[model samples]
Target: MSVQDAFAAPRSAVRDVNGGTGAITDTVINALKKTRPWVLFLAILGFIGAALTLLVGIAVVISSMMMGNLEGMDAEIAPFGSGMMIGVGVLYAVMAVIYFLSALYLLRYAGAIKRLSSSLSVADLEAALEQQASFWKLIGILVLISIVLTVVMLLAGLGGALFMGAAGL
Candidate 1:
């Protein structure tokens, strides 16, 4: 589809290469079958990674708390201030949640493919597409966030450099 037409067309107006309403062809089915395993694998990996991250987050928080309670330790002696450690732990926990959600979306998409394999129903195909769309949407949002964060960090670094220079440091 032309770029103009693509933007103008509604989802229902989508057409296949043969200029017909998008239909699940045998090729499409085969592709889905081939890809299902990869999708499932990704989902499993995400789940595992998220679980590990969550564990790390919890451990970090506990360690920080324990460090704060140590009688012989002073703030200057601690590797990191308890507040900073807690903040890092919270960030890790938030990342774990995001990772888990991405994994959940992939798992649901895989399930849709499994159903389509068994039934070859248009409904199943639609469901699979919806799940796939959700996964892509999440990834797109994450990409945007990463870009913004990079820009912010760069600006902050530049600002710090200028400040240090002005202070004759």
Candidate 2:
């Protein structure tokens, strides 16, 4: 059958396999609508976190420079601080990239939801869902990486801070 013919509705199956006018589609669309807002909120939060990390890194660098004792500081502690800062910066950059990619995926999903709402064929809906699943998988990987990086950065910062405090620097 031609592509158009495949998308054509099956008259005999108008009532669907079970009872009701395809309420499952409506349910899924509603869920997507509810989820879109949360996704947008998360993206915004990610951006904010990245911005805060950048600001904190800048503050640390400035404070270190102004201390005049930057060169006099313990070499071990200095390396730890520098490494922590660099790790945090890398984490923030990764988070920003993840946020942008996830946002794009969510926006595309939102568009698909709209098309489904407007009575897209089941084939079209299925295709959209397949594409969404791939995007979700990528998003999941990015989120996991971001979490791991953030934790590493946090631990490094804590260790550096403790060392600095103990050394009376």
Candidate 3:
């Protein structure tokens, strides 16, 4: 037999070179979809926490101003600052949970993509690339929103503190 025929025989003997089983891709996609709702919920929660922090900060400033004229009341009114502190604490905790869950989801997604890419034909790989691009875009948006909320909360706390101190409370 010619060398060409020998190579052809071996190629024909093997089957499903492209990993015919679709289980790996399916598992990855399902995992991503499952985690999406949790991430979205966390994003909404973050926004709500930030808003609460801002409102609490504003209230503290206004309250301090109204009570400024009262004598020997500084120690008694100091407990009012607890609201802002609690808000910051809750927001930080929520952000930490979001970060942890997102990291896990991303790792799983990456593994799935790698497996699928290796097992798919050229055409299938191209399609997966497009899907992966969209997925990353969504994750990026979430990350940006999370960061913005954190920054705004921090600034609000700082502003409230400065305002309260200025009021002599």
TM-scores for candidates 1 onward, in order = 0.81, 0.49, 0.37
Model 1 worst lDDT window (10 residues): 12-21
Q: How would the candidate models be sorted by lDDT, starting from the highest?
A: 1, 2, 3
Task: List model 2 lDDT by residue over 21-98, tens digit each.
Answer: 342445565676677567557656655665665666566555545553466878778777766666665655555566
**Candidate 3: residue 30 lDDT (0-100):** 53
- Model 2: lDDT equals 0.64
In order, candidate lDDTs are 0.89, 0.64, 0.56
Q: Assess candidate 1 and give its lDDT.
A: 0.89
lDDT of 1 at 34: 94
Better of 2 and 3 by lDDT: 2
- The prediction achieving the highest TM-score against the true structure is 1
Worst 10 residues of 2 by lDDT: 13-22
The TM-score ranking, best first, is 1, 2, 3
Give the better candidate number (2 or 3) by TM-score: 2
Q: Candidate 3's residue-wise lDDT over 1-169, tens digit each?
A: 6547554645432234346632234444455556545645654555565566556555655655555545666665555555455555565555555555454444444554555545544344455555556557767888899799899999999999999999988
